[model samples]
Target chain A: MSSFAPPVQRLITELGRLPGIGGRTAQRLAFHLLRASEEDALALAEAIKEVKARIGLCEVCFNLSDGPRCRICSDERRDAGLVCVVEEPSDIIPIERTHEFHGRYHVLGGALSPIDGIDPEDLRIAELYTRVTPPADAPQDEHPTPIREVVLATNPTTTGEATALHIAAHLREQAPQVTVTRLASGLPVGADLEYADELTLGRALSGRRALS
Target chain B: MSSFAPPVQRLITELGRLPGIGGRTAQRLAFHLLRASEEDALALAEAIKEVKARIGLCEVCFNLSDGPRCRICSDERRDAGLVCVVEEPSDIIPIERTHEFHGRYHVLGGALSPIDGIDPEDLRIAELYTRVTPPADAPQDEHPTPIREVVLATNPTTTGEATALHIAAHLREQAPQVTVTRLASGLPVGADLEYADELTLGRALSGRRALS
Candidate 1:
């Protein structure tokens, strides 16, 4: 009704919803798609649908996966006794790229932000304890080996800190024989791990500290 | 192989195919979707498919439309004597928002870019000329009113300027009785009308001048 034909308006609206795409950019993008070949426009659409339908959460580590477990979780080379806990699946990539830590991962799904109502109960913290200290028989496997160390790689943000503390405390109680560590302190405080440079994340992983 | 899971990499490669979304941003957005709620992620996928499936070019004006004729072209109340010609459908939105031009529109689809191999034949120029010189029986019920003026609202870019000039020359030769005018010069040179502030665009519109 605001002058644009409904179809034109709808394309713009959807494009604007994407991150960093503004109204003007969205309009430009919509027009570009309109002007492009039908095959190209349909290609973008198919890509979006294919990614959503085919990809899923890794059963063991909760990372994005196309099958039963993420590539890292399925790999025989990664250390079974070492698992790094982080806030989101995206955080796992930079660490994995470094090739510095040949260990598995545990995606918490999100961090502990009480104000945001994200408590330990909301995250996969209980799952971490369960994975590290399995109840003798997990029904799926004989026994989840007594994990030797769990490096808390959650972002250095406020919520990340709280989640790390909660995990550190819980792991100490549940898996007393296991060591719980936090990624090193040099990460720019309050920044998300996704934005950190490879060198910094690598250093943090290599120089991790034991939780007191 | 390069640190990303195959599906994640595939999704990133596909997302990078969009205009403006690059490799790093594609990776970031792909991961964002991985963590996003299934409904929200699928909504984005559905929106992409829906827009492409439902929208098509308006046969009358060549603008994006849900039906045969564009909404503006189909409207009975529009001033048929006044037709605004623009390089793209997105241009229609700003002019429509002004409320100053009650005229319908003809989207040229693109400008005359000889360097890019886009010529008058590639655009809706012939159709515009035909619109200017109406059908023989067009006004059998009412007094025949030849199109009074064509407001060329193409962007201020080099190609846009050339396109406007080309159309003006054609209209002068084909429809001698019709007056041709380009949207005014106050529009910033080399800038797109889509990004022009409404006030500036409206002013340029109100102060439009006849092309010699």
Candidate 2:
């Protein structure tokens, strides 16, 4: 049997499952939690429980929410006609941090990865299509807003690019009026974005040759 | 108001409070938990609760335990006469992994730091003395095991060295029969044991001069 008690071992194991956290890091984190005040430790537990119990996906945008719709989708100030599509809910944060996008967002849950068995159908592609093209027999009291622009703000990775292309092709056939665009590919403001290959960088550089 | 819902934001804040987790990492972890299966997420929560509820400290060694005494102290095989002193309970794991020491441990909670207001009284120094020299009135049926060797296994930091020296001096005056030995100062098996400073390297070099 392991030297550590069952409960302590379990905590360590659970912590190690997190991204970037190794076994040693997990042990350190567990010990830190143990040394912390009961109130502080329990607060973290309560926070995890509360988030799981209360927060869910926004019905319209698939962003994290406490109710049927996320705060972004419910806000009257955000432009409904200009939708920025992203791969994951976490992707939206950096965009928001930039304060460059005033439009609404469509979270795809994840990008298309054929190797990982993720496809167009696996994403929120159908939902996005519906948003761009509403039914003709919609309620008279609530007029549906026609999406003018669908910025494919997915990650610059191969999967992200493939997802954007797949959705763009579908939108063109499904709704001809909507304009689709991808985030500019170039050296990031700071460093790398997703794990976009070096060849993609060459293309990005070629595209940006005249700008500099 | 923040863009994220209250519960989501609260979880991110709580996650950020952990030792190496920054705001971005916390947000990622919080979202990963949100995306994880309810079973997986709740298991982590349950583990945290269980550890706090069940685990306490080893009465003799101060290591983490489920009952009055830790497993090491209760074990019949481990020698009580030879105790390895460490700064924290977490430090015991590495020594155990090495399989070099079969003795019991005494966790001092932390190394002495006068600048941080930590003194001899702040640590379990007096308790170490008591363990080394038991009461004469102890029953013959319950014979106290006299500690022969005290290994100063504290980290090789400035504070750790100072703490070791302080304990060694006290042991010299109080229990001259007991031998107090600090861990050998040398190059680590692998580089980078939490940024070993220049002075520690210098000490290691001086100690290794004859052999090299």
Candidate 3:
């Protein structure tokens, strides 16, 4: 028989299902909740329920949202003509933290990985194309401000690179007027040159900029 | 304004309150939950609620239990006369895993820490004494099997040492017939002598037994 009671074992099982949590961590967390005040423990439970009940994907950008559209999609202040495409909703936060992108975002849901069975059709790539391209029935002037540029801000991983290239090629054929760009790849700031990986060093050498 | 919606922010805040979880980890967990299926997410929330609602301290030994008495306390086969005293309910798991002790346990709830205002009164030390010492009003034959021995299985920390010493003194005065002992302090089973700390090495030397 298990040392812990049924309920404790159940809680540990559920907590262990989380992405990074292991069995020991789940046990520790369960014990902590048991020791915590009723109000505090219930707060964590209520928060989990509330997030699940209220949060959904944005209709337009596919970013996580509390309503039909995400905050960025609803905001008129952000540049609608410039779209930064990322692999997931979580990717938008870091870019937002920088205050570097004044434009909206397009969450692909996930990157392409053939070995993992994730393909172009599996992602929200078609939805992205539709968002960028105007309808055939609509007049040229009907949509005054068309998407001018697309910044592929997918992760620098192999899958992210493949997904970005696939989308960029499709966008070129679908919307010839739109400009496609990729985020700069080089050694990170504050990094020692000696410790830089061969691939990163090569990218840094090839993409080196001239002194102003 | 917060970058995330109210529910997402609330979840992150609650997760951040957990031990070792920081803001970034909290955010990562919140995002992971958001991405998870509704059933999977609800299971975690329900688990938290169930653990809080169903689990309570064992009435007899003070270990976490789903009922009045914990598993160890309820077991007839275990040695009730031999008690192992620990600081918290969490400590019981490791001892149970070792399978070296067949004795029942007494959870003190916490250790003695004068700086933190924790004293004998704050713990279940008095309850332990009550369990060890039979009532004066009871006849000798009324309680056939009296407590015979107590093993102070508290941590090796300063507070734990003080708590064990205090309990030993009280047990000696109140129930002189019972044998009281503390867990030995020394180098761990699989440790190397070169990396051993001075205090631990000294304890190993002092506690060494004669080679047969």
State which candidate, 1 or 3, has the greater lDDT.
Answer: 3
Question: Per-residue lDDT tens digits of candidate 2, residues A28-95?
Answer: 99999999888888888888899889988899999988999899988889998999999888888889
lDDT for residue A85 in candidate 3, whole number 0-100: 97
Estimate the overall C-alpha local distance difference test score of candidate 2: 0.87
Order the numbered candidates by lDDT, best leading: 3, 2, 1
- Label model 2 with its docking quality class: medium
- Candidate number that wins on DockQ, 2 or 3: 3
Candidate 1 DockQ category?
acceptable
The candidate scoring highest on TM-score is 3
lDDT per residue, candidate 1, B114-140, as tens digits? 899998889888888767776677666
Worst 10 residues of 1 chain B by lDDT: B137-146
lDDT of each: 0.80, 0.87, 0.90
TM-score, ranked from best to worst? 3, 2, 1
